[model samples]
Target: MNCRRLNIINRNSQRLLFLVNQLLDFKKVEQNGFTVQFSRQNVTNLVTAVAERFAPSIEQMGGKLVVEQCERDIEADVDAEALTKLVSNLLNNARKYMKDRIVIACHADEGQGWFTISVSDNGVGISRDNQEKIFKPFFQVMDDNRESKGGTGLGLSIVQSVVEAHKGEIKVESSLGNGATFIVTLPLRQEGVTASAGNDIMSPAEDKGCSRAIDGGVNDVSRPVMLIVDDNEEMLQFITSNFNSDYEVVTAVNGKEALDKLSRHEVALIVSDWMMPVMNGVELCRAVRSNCNYSHIPFILLTAKTDNYSKIEGLNCGADAYVEKPFSVNYLEARIHNLVEMRKLLREKFSQTPLEPINTIAPNPVDDQFLTQLTNIIEENFSNPELSVDFLANRMGISRSGLYAKIKTLANVTPNELIQLTRLKKAAKLLAENKYRINEICYMVGFNSSSYFSKCFQRQFGIKPGEFTPHSL
Candidate 1:
């Protein structure tokens, strides 16, 4: 084909694909709900309809599209449009790039409460290097060469996003010269899930669960106010965006302003920076803790300080948590959720408690000594991921086994767990105050994955990180 003819063909093809993709995308979004109507017949008809639509395209590309037969009809609680888009994207990719044959398969196991639909293509396979990048937005490996097909590069990204939105996962397996296979797994619809009508697909119960998870059950009217302290405009904007959805977020530029805000407002949580002028986080924490009125309110310190001494000092100075810098949005959100939940729960507990007579509480001398020593160790090597039992023991001139035993005896937990717990708790506070995202919070707290950070948060608090933020209140 001439250059002009090829260009014309490419444009026409892209336009057609774009229209089809948009229609499918719209359908998925529109039909997604807690209860969707799909019987075995419906699934079959839908699959057949999609296959027929793509068959001509596949034939034009000299590729055969084969649909593998399953033993029984598969009915799933899924948006048909979403599923169709996923399947169609996979098929289109295979047909466009694959060398010869494409296989589309669906499997249903009612006993397992899960169904899987997969598309396998025998084409010029994707390299390992490009597999992960393929799902990212506007990323195309085959750019403008003759062999390079036409696409806007949004297909796979959209597919992944839609799947994740539906609470599902997409997995890809490919090797250079070996074709790629894409698998999508979804929850099978049984009688348990309520089927609801309207474009708002999630059931009332699911919505409640999501709301409860993202926002702690603080009544909107009674939710404690929060004051955010940050100097960077971008950081402040990001923080505000994350919290404005649920909380009445107020921002301050520095510790001095933070104190000023606290004086004027009944702030439930104070999130301040460690490096701010006029007063740093330690100074702010000390100031707040010293005052009887603000002492009860939880204080969270955000800083780039990874040193153990810094964290310990912040915690010791009445800061509820100390989140480190360079955190993820999700991790930060999770942490915020955690602190909010804790604050709400504590408020409830305190409200229910009978007033106690004034009494002097003695400080534990042993705890002070231990905390001092721990601070020294953490300060010495906060950057070391393996700064755990072996490292601490080595530093203290003791054996690994002995150090582990001693730490357990003193702290009632493993040394590593304690360290991680401390890091996560601090991270959670930063998150609740909308200081960072989950991923940033993960790194800030010395974690590698937002998912891992979330798991750790759940383990520590018996709730997901998202549930810590007060949504209603």
Candidate 2:
């Protein structure tokens, strides 16, 4: 048999196995005997592996499956076997209803203390009324012809049970024509935690400790831009007024509008409401984190949702912090200041050690990958005197201005300065090796004039090249 045909058979067998397991899980759920065996496991690795299993089959069906993996693995106390089944069922259902693409995103919010996994697909969407019913046992949304697609309809039902058993919650967002997104949020650690269906598992008091009141002085001129989004005009103005003295406050009524503002302005931070028309804060957070341009911006989600699951959902989508509604203005302002200052400190660290590993600071995966690629390119071409910022930008597949901005934000240095630093570091290494004279090493590392190289080296290292020793690094 051909490979494609064999792959189909393999996929069918896996589906059949899952169906059998689903029926067994349904029985367990009905009998209330489905006890989760919780142990600490790396959730990111497990979820990524499960998502990969459906890729070949989805591709065979002329569909695409995109799995967004995190840079850092999230270790959580979970029933590994049950979580595997939960993800498998989600992928299977997406495969059934998806038109051409399915996206799976996984993130862990240490700040909010939740691990989140979301499965989305572009296909026939679910209506608001049916959204609640779709999780019921043996429930399926029939087509216009009043025919079921296929399955016992126990997949999502079992998924919900697994989530509840793990003291987590599953939520679905969809409409008639738009696609659907299923978000499953679980605690980072399941210990001494008791929860029942529809119960608030955690108290807001547990989150109050995260609110730091450190003050970073604000400037009157050239203030950092802050985006405040809310559907309610009153709430929008309220937040804007509070931050007006500190930031160049811009207002948007929804996530779409917020994104429009992001494109037009260099936003320093974002504060948004949870519920709104067009798009909500969680969706906006996800969109911002998915794009490299805005991923590093500190996001603060303001919501009335006090439940543990809701907080996890918001933070897992990449909100740097969460503030419950009717929140203290002082607390909110403190958190905003804390997040901005923390990023500034991180940038300072990176600037001091530009050649350090990206994983050292544990930035988002997108930025980590970008910096890794960038450093590799620079290291490979550092000896080329013709290597310019524009050339590096082209190689990085970004505009010159974008590269300049990213490097400045990330490393607290311009692109040209970064390149020069990279060359100087290389020259430092060569000098430490005691393998060549200063002149030879200077020419070898792309410096044409020894006198100029000496000056730059002294400026960067606070000592002349000849004064550099192995311990100086």
Candidate 3:
């Protein structure tokens, strides 16, 4: 038999095995209730293995499957059997809707105690409206031809159950005409604590991982908000004095108070002491990781708890970075700068080159499709003067905030900035051709006012549009 036929056989065998296990799991749930048997498994390998099982089907659909390996192995205390099913269900779900491409990856956010595996696709992207319903018992992406026939309608539901059983969480990233990304995050081993799926120490996973090919994430202009939580007044003052010059620092006595501060402000990073009067740093880390709004913030735990178990506890609770007391101010400062810079780079979008010979910089299919479709939308409506975030978001079928976050994560720019960037790049191209008058070229690229176009043109190209004829351009 050919390799392709063998792949198809392996794919069918995997799916058949998944369904049999599903029946057994249902019986177990009905009789004794669902549960997980924790074992130390290398998550990166698990994700890669499961993705390979679906490779034949993905290929048969005229699609490609890409497995992204992380910088290191991400091991977690999980039920190998259940985790396999969880991954398998996710694969089957993707195969049902996605036809062009599929990419799977796993990574360990050690600071936040999260090990994540994402399966993304580049076909029949789910709409925001259906996202809410897709996880329900019998929901499927709306299609008159394929709607009720996708599967038992229990794949994602089972996937969700498996996630909760492992004390982890799952979420979907997608939009109409943009592909979907199903992100699953699980807990790793933390000493001095028993593994329980009940604890649920995790964030929503990602709105997060963007790549800019050779470049990186855009630095925020508004002094990025930083929150510091330490009960000691002297330490707070000293730390605040040092960092205030670079960051807009806010101080809190404990984790509870820190959360209140977070609610009122959009904080980019956090620094906290492990032992405090009311709520300690570990507790604060857990709280932050559980909240989707603040989970993505980089956390640095600064404290005296320097033991191995203490470090494990701190990281397992979602602390992104750690600093021990009696530390040098210079040491802490350097660590903070490095962590924040890495975070910035991770959020930058793929490449910004034109769409003719497309180069995808995103880590997954969902982002790749979104960027491709977004580029198409911009080009198709290139002459429409009203092309803005709202317009783009409406066309994409996602909310304004969802659009903003995804674009920011994938492109490292605000919606307005992306629109302006697209328009300006087009305008620059027209200028290079020297085909029309400045005002005419401006209007041709969707600019309404000539003066405003000139200002923007100068801002982007470092010269007045008039200075650029064919030779000058």
Candidate 4:
């Protein structure tokens, strides 16, 4: 075959593949939902790259690619990857439908905290009736001599989705005989701490340092630690800014990174993105649950995947909460505080509650057996005031660390907590039966101090032992 003819065939194949890729990309956004990870980016450089990429192709089709003399380097909080795709899709539509030339332009209005990008083509324009439906997925325009063309109608739909993900707007200005211009306007930054304005310019790689320590500041060991996981750097910074006052915020780019951080840090809670490059949130949740040390940490998955199936899967994977993207900052702060408080309550409850009797208490059979054996040993040593982790470890034929790992994995509570919980349950039962006075019950259940017993009981069940009579029980 002639080389020119073969090249033409190759071009067609590339276009088909492009369509397939676009379809897959859009489907993922639709099914899993999308969260725009924002950062400071040069809109001009991004658009220029896209234009240069297709310039040769446009030239081959008897057209020229012109980047207009608009604000060339507008820097703002934008998801560069999504913006790249959006601009590429618009360029592709222009290449396919109208024009001897394609033009790209951008403007930034910092006063209004907004920015805009417009792509125009002088090709065969769209009719007013058709313009209304152009951005709908797979809606191709019909025109004179429109036959013998290969195109996926997904281009504009993808453009629209990207715009919406950034909390932006998109519209078309066109007439049948006139040309078409697709313009996109986006906020320079989202309002208040759910997202922070990034730097004036950025590279493809993000700084991973912000999550652990910022500006090389010494680590504050006194503050409670929180793990913020999201692929977007701006979001991580934003979340950190909001939580830094109350908690020591550490950042991670994805689930895998978060897991690595957990291996090293005593994180109190985790807020993660559902979809990310390395490992997504659900996988991280499952991994965290399976781990002995990290299982007890509260997990909140912040994602755009709000579909029922996705939400259920996230919850099933061990996420304590599911927060959708474009989420309210107030709601997120409240939710985080709530999860932390709930976690404290849960651990206290685990320390006090009976873990045996699978049908009644334990959820899994393995846990039931483990708890049954552990509780039996506790009962055997119930009267010993010297009962401690070292004593329990020796009795169980495991090291202290091994015991901690086992109990944490099983009940998301420490072995010491389990022992305390066992004793509390015994004391509560004795009190409920009115078989012993509060002092006697405390000593009998291995508690040295009746006052301490009262405090623990109040914390576990919201009632003082003296006030929690048989009738109350």
Candidate 5:
């Protein structure tokens, strides 16, 4: 197991795995199990990461590989895993036939709402007749002078399947002796998701079950606010119409507008589209989770990306659930209801164990940090009888009402109750230690009145302080 031999084995293993994956993918297509799972992806990043994977091998083979730099990030709703395969297959084919160089470029047309990715190589170009037949399964160009390049010959066919599944088109430009370029054009967003551009327009068909126009704000303050964000006006309308009876539906065209709405209203949950201009869904989810004020609200990502990778990424970003496109209305409603009910159950659980690590309750680092800071403040001032909610809010650099709202939302308890709970939990630990007298333990934990402390302690732990034993803990 020398270093060089190990490296060679590793490289070969990777190549073999790649080939096997390709074969499996093509098999899936043949069996009609190949599905495109679309999500909001940065086109430039996807292209760069995928093309760079092949760059080293191509350069090692003495071929110059150039991935053109885009001026700005181009984002689109696309099946990332499938697109990765398509780029890899094209690059692999080019590497096998390239004389010296290969080039990859991406361009977007904002007006037409489409983007194109082109891969070109200075290889033995396909003939006019062969170009038409190249994407067929197991079809390969046979030439007399060139060495036989080994492959399953299903690369172009898989690429075509990926493109067609995404409702896009792919074309090839090539002639004998000249280089060949494969150009793939896909929509910036999927069809049926037209850009609203901050407008709230809906078709007659879309307006069938809706009563009022979506005004991009809270509809009824009496109901729990649920923010619905999407670039498609029709989608916003559809969701709002369905949830309006039970929720104060707030609509936004994109993530930026959604954040604005969140700032103004107390949202119970969020249902956001993955792809949009200004900001995307994953970015929004991260932002919400990082903000202590909104972190407790359950988030559901509405996307066409049903792939396991996309679902994991979405959930990792703090989304409570991921709903795929063309999803059933009943299923989406159920997911939303379950997530909201789950949050309420968590609140009840946290309320029962107020001294528990807040991170365990919220499961978000930012929320944990905020809760820990609050807990630390309370613990430090436990001996001071003057400690109050207003003092705590001032120390925490938040307004009194804001602190109350946040604590209520996260802990399901008032700020004053939280302070008392912290003191009682410490008292219980001291009692369990059996080193302090009952009155001493009460005073040590910040209770001036021993009788009052015992009453509160008994109320919390369900036993009189004098009868408390380690076993009761």
Candidate 6:
């Protein structure tokens, strides 16, 4: 068959398979007394079933399926039907694209109550540019090739959605020609929620209601109060839109205006462009620091210039962090979260010990050591986009559980939380200085998406970054 015809067939097959699985899940849900039952299943068994189901096709394509068993049982609490579909889609993709042997490895740690199910193949792996897009719906890395291979470009996206529904995380490790490994980690069971009661199967509307309720309360507590300092009206509106959620955003076009707003209302954070007509980010930071009342408020400098000297100059002028232009929203959100957490801690400590200096050392040396090591590790990998808890644990030669425990004991935050905080602090400095475009600043701080970044940034700052201009106060 021609590539196009084959692709059409593949798409049809995938859709058919998805429909069948959905029906099966629905049936299973009905049979299981309408309770969401999270059960522990073996990864090896799951992969074997999926591979066997696709054996005929694999054999026709002249490929072999290889299963690798780790020393432990790879177990997770998942809806059996959904989990099965996730595995099947991954394996199906591997078999269709690969010319040789496909390997499925199961790694589990009973102590940690987690597992990583990885399906890999000697096929043409995903390119770096296409990696992120792959999880997005209807985004196929190779449209022409995939057409011939018969893919609807929805397999990975479905996999992602299903995994997220199960409250798990999925990641891809791939490079062109090297092979691709899709790893999924899920909890053995939902913590605090009993499996005996079954999974709480809620309708879409009910789920939305629950989410709204949760978000409503969170919005009240975590709403960001942003102070924007920019001279451009268009830029101010653009920045404000990026952070309206989770923020009571305010705006000013210049330093004086920002300072005036600051005086009138309490702002959690400041996002300022570096080059402004009347008073810039550097000038603003200087002004804020000079004022005894506002010196403690976090400041971020956003600039288009990605020079070492410029960054240093901004930092020296009391900017907490710096971000270059053309940044990702994900990076900016992470940075903002970090700064906000720091400010919260500082405020709490300041309130508790009014007479004491804020710089008092941590009481525990063990915690101090761990924090130092963590800080060093974070600094070393500050530029890495995938620098997360998993990455940190792998780098530190510790298990995820161990890393979490150590971080919680030493830093008073989870490893993931710490990473987010670190990134947020860095982004805050750039925003306060206002040197770069908001989008540019987001990615420069290592966030993958600007919308997500703004949400996070607003959560930390109590206002949108666009409204926290030095001139406003």
Top TM-score model: 5
**TM-score (all chains, Cα) for each model:** 0.36, 0.49, 0.38, 0.43, 0.51, 0.35
Best candidate according to lDDT: 5
lDDT of each: 0.62, 0.77, 0.70, 0.72, 0.78, 0.65
Each prediction's total of clashing residue pairs, residues at least 3 apart in sequence or on different chains, is: 32, 0, 4, 5, 0, 88
The local distance difference test score of model 1 is 0.62
Tens digit per residue, CA lDDT, model 2, 87-153: 9889988888888999999898899999899999997889989998999999998876788889989
lDDT of 4 by residue, 72-105 (tens): 5777777877887898899988888666988888
Candidate 5: global Cα-lDDT?
0.78
Report lDDT (Cα) of residue 298, candidate 3: 73
Q: Output the better candidate (4/5) by TM-score.
A: 5
Can you rank all candidates by TM-score, best first?
5, 2, 4, 3, 1, 6
Clashing pairs in 4: 98-123, 99-123, 211-250, 211-251, 351-421
Tens digits of lDDT, candidate 5, 1-473: 56567457646765676677778888999999568766667778778776766777788899989999878999898877788788889899889878899999999999999999999999888899989998998888876565458888889999999899888899999988887999999889885343432234534433222111112111222557889999865567557755664577899988988899988888877999997789999999999998777887778899978899999998999988989875656699899778766766665554444233456556567777888899889889987767999999988887787787677666656677778777876776677777989989878888888888877776555677788766654
RMSD of each: 23.4, 20.5, 25.9, 14.0, 17.5, 24.7
lDDT of prediction 3:
0.70
Runs in model 4 lying further than 4 Å from the true structure: 1-221, 344-376, 384-386, 393-421, 434-444, 447-468
What's model 3's lDDT at 147? 44
Which pairs clash in the backbone of model 3? 111-319, 111-320, 349-410, 349-411
Model 6, 219-270: lDDT tens digits are: 1224547897777554565456446544678998788888999777667678
lDDT of 3 by residue, 148-266 (tens): 53456777877888888778888899876677899998788633343543344444313222222223234434666789998866567657755664578899999899999987876
| lDDT winner, 5 or 6 | 5
Q: Tens digits of per-residue lDDT for model 1 on 1-473?
A: 46567446644754675656555554564466222344233455456557766765577678788888888777666666456666667777777778878888888777877778888887767888888799876677672253567666667877786576556778888886778899987767544343532223233433321121212222233434778887654456556654553456889888788888877776766777787667777887787766533554557788879998877887888776778765544566777779656545543332222121001110123333444566467544556767777777767665665545434323334556546545654665676687777778777766777787787666555567666663411
lDDT of 3 at 336: 86
